[model samples]
Target: MSGIMKISDKEFYSLRSLILEHFGINIQEQKRTLLVVRLQKLLQAQGFKTFREYYNYLIRDSSPDRLHELIDSISTNFSFFFREHKHFDYLSKTVLPLLVERQKKRNSKNIRIWSAGCSTGEEPYTIVMLMLEFFGIEYAMWNAGVLATDISTRALKKAMKGIYSQDKIRHVPAGLNKKFFNKADEGKLVINETIRNNVTFRRLNLMKPTFPFKKKFHIIFCRNVMIYFNQQTRNDLIRKFHNVSKPGSFLFIGHSETLDTSRNLYKYVMPATYMRI
Candidate 1:
């Protein structure tokens, strides 16, 4: 392997601009050293001598998958099952009941949910488990499933595999854990096919100008994903989300993230929760 490829100021700026333009990720000046450290191994493996070469290669690469690889390196995928217990509580006590009532009134059993930026599938799986518990035997009658998406193909692959270390599921409720995961040979827990089948994982870049979802979602969970984006990018992405949400649908963001209620597209239902107007 080549000696650590040094990232000069100009090269760093060039790569920074590329990331901001394409991924909406604003790499602050303080993160310069972190960026270089994180990407050094990838640069060596790809045989790029400098960050400039990597930037050039990224722009010229015809296949979109290369971009996904870059994102996988830069993005953090730290998550656990039922990471935010309150959100699950609100979902079961409020959102699901409302959705069920509305769908019943419409004479439709379809329940649409989108788990945007679902890293490694924990959030979506938690959602599916709740829905199953909510409907119990009637769950089989509804066409309910989660559309889980993230930009990192690497994370999605692990999510699709439905495997996790036993400690990784420590936050999951005991009864749900017993029902949904099978104990594997080496202290690993494998999500049952039933739970895995309820979620569909996809590679989706939230920076896109327009979303191509065929139907508007009843609930959109895009937590913690916007922390990397600048204010403008977050606003723009939220607008796109608004357009793709059904009226009165719920939008769940990270507890640390807040929407500009001044936009009036959605009303504040609770902390980090909004209802589409």
Candidate 2:
């Protein structure tokens, strides 16, 4: 505790306001100490002596890189392959099958899925694997892939590497693991090119006023990403998602999250699952 730097209340509020305005993350008052602790090393590395100085530097920096770094420091990036199993079951049992049938009727082979806030690539990769398994030999006939976006460039870099420790992939279903991953040195599993190539990872901030996607998505997985936001931010983001989703498209959120269906953009399908109406 002797070497620890404390953030003044005013400094904490200033930093909190900036983060809320730019990233839509509402840091609670209780997290003031946590914020100081998390940012202490960053400040030392940047040679800043006080939180006020760091705040000034953050505002003066023109490039988004600093902001990104701040986000990387503050945001939690906890994820693994198939962290929640029920959603995957729903995806396999209901969503993909319906989409496939709909597309077939239209004589179209294109399938679009968006994995919003896909940290370190687990969720999106799992989706691609499921699609491949669902279509089997016919997968090659369809223009199907997943667009995985997250705010952390660091996470995206790790996702692009396509390597995971055995522990990280421990919950991956059997047989599929053998088919999609190869054993590397030091007990690591490297994702095969087939699954890795089908999932594209990009850095995107969900707080942005506009999403720059040209095509509407049939399925959007934004699980566990909105827990950091306030209710207003979450509602605004859900509206944006509804606008960009095809009618009747599936939206999968974390099991702990609930939507205010009164907005009428989406109708409840099940816990944490909604269909764009």
Candidate 3:
């Protein structure tokens, strides 16, 4: 294994540019150390003596698996069940009710929601549970389900397994937690099959020029995902999202992230929430 490898300026720029191009993550000059810290172990384990070598190999490799591994190391997947409770509250009180009313008038029972950048399945599962709670017996009648996607295959694998330690779900309301998760040995909880089946997990890179979704979504939860992107990337990505959503659909972003409302594509509905115009 290589010991104490340092990234030269050229190497940093090369790798940083690749990451930006592929993942829309802008690694600033200040984050040079951060990039190294995140990838040092992978570099050593893979027997690369320097960042340049790793970058070269990445460019030479035709398959996407290596790039996926690189992203798994670089991307931060910090999420917990009910991480932002207010979104669920809004869904239950405002969004779902409104959607139900609209669907009722159209006589269409389809309800589409997308959890873009869903990490470790918490956000999507929470949405499923909320839908279950909201519709109760009628849930089966509506064609409602969550499309959960992330760039990290590692995270998606964990999401598909639907297992979480007790601490990860501590914030989940006791009632919902009890209803949605089954107790596993060693204090881990497995998300129930019903809730698990309601969410479809997929590995997707948000930087793709076009999303392959054939149907427009009614609600999109892209919280905390765009924080890694720069202004231009965010704009393009949000425009793509707008294009793939139904008119008057809802978009939920992270509390720390803000959108330029002046674009007129989306109107501000609430804190970190917007409506497609």
lDDT tens digits, residues 198-237, model 1?
9999989899999989999999999989999999999999
TM-score to native of every candidate shown:
0.96, 0.97, 0.97
**lDDT for each residue of candidate 2 in 1-277, tens digit (9 for 90 to 100):** 3477988889999999999998888999998878888888889989999999999999997579899889888877889998788889999999989998999899999889999999899899999889889999999999999999999888999999888998788888899999999988888999999999899888889998889999999999999989889999999999999988899899999988888999899999988999999
Candidates in descending TM-score order:
3, 2, 1
lDDT for each residue of candidate 3 in 77-103, tens digit (9 for 90 to 100)? 999998878988999999999999999
Candidate 3, residue 153: how far the Cα is off, in Å: 0.3
Q: So what's the TM-score on candidate 1?
A: 0.96
Model 3 ranges with Cα > 4 A deviation = 1-4
Comparing candidate 2 with candidate 3, which one achieves the higher lDDT?
A: 3
**Candidate 1 — which pairs collide?**
none
Worst 10 residues of 2 by lDDT: 1-10
